[model samples]
Target: MGRKKIELKKIECPKEKSSKYSKRKKGLLKKAEEMAVLCDSDIILLVFSPTSKPNLFYPHSRPLGRILERLSNMSEYEREERRSYTKKV
Candidate 1:
């Protein structure tokens, strides 16, 4: 039998919501790290919690400031060009 699809809604209980958020955040951070290493590219992930606390993830082997500076220096067109090139097979 096929698996049942879970309804998408905000988790009501605070404890359950926190637990789910923690688990999912950990998994997302792991994937971000893997992608940075596998692609040999600079990647930054910023997530804010309900409390407005920020969490940042990037390739630890690379300088975080350098990555941010490079990203900040990129023009909007350059950023879009890079994304387009990457999307092309």
Candidate 2:
């Protein structure tokens, strides 16, 4: 069950923003854990709050740095390919 849709803009009230952040953060982490358990796969979730605080979760027994590096390299390669294709066209 999800909450009703709301605008993405910042909440003016500090208390309300804090409450919302806590709830959503917990919900996301729970979902991540559930997916990892159900699929038997590696899952890394990194979230940054408005205050720049980071929350990291690793469901599998893998190093966080290694996974981030691999994902970064993959995205870079894809970006380069896309650039080359656009230049040729």
Candidate 3:
């Protein structure tokens, strides 16, 4: 059987929401791992629960610190590009 579409609104019942969250979170992490393995790509996933618990996923070859550092560097590069473009305009 196929899955049905789910609405984008918040689930009203806390118990139902929690159950859905747990199932979907596992599926999402599994998909991330599969993509990394099949595509030979680095994957890092960080999710916070409704109660603010952290769940982190790093593929076998990827390090969380390295991912954060690379993301920080990219943001800096993007900011510089934006500033230069603004100055030229």
Measured against the true structure, the TM-scores of the candidates, in listed sequence, are 0.76, 0.60, 0.69
Candidate 2 weakest ten by summed lDDT: 59-68
Cα lDDT, all candidates = 0.89, 0.83, 0.86
Candidate 1 per-residue lDDT over residues 1-89, each given as its tens digit: 99999999998888898888899999999998998889998888999875678998888899999998998899999999988999995
Which lDDT tens digits does candidate 2 get at residues 1-89?
A: 99999768868887888889999999999998898888866779889986789988987556778767766777777979978999999
Who is ahead in lDDT, 2 or 3? 3
Model 3 worst lDDT window (10 residues): 67-76
Candidate 3 has an lDDT of 0.86
Question: Comparing 1 and 3 by lDDT, which wins?
Answer: 1
Off by over 4 Å in 1: 1-4, 80-89
What is the C-alpha local distance difference test score of candidate 1?
A: 0.89
Residue 39, candidate 2: alpha-carbon lDDT: 86
Quote the lDDT for 18 in model 1.
Answer: 81
Residue 69 displacement (Å), model 3: 4.1
Sorted by lDDT (best first), the order is 1, 3, 2
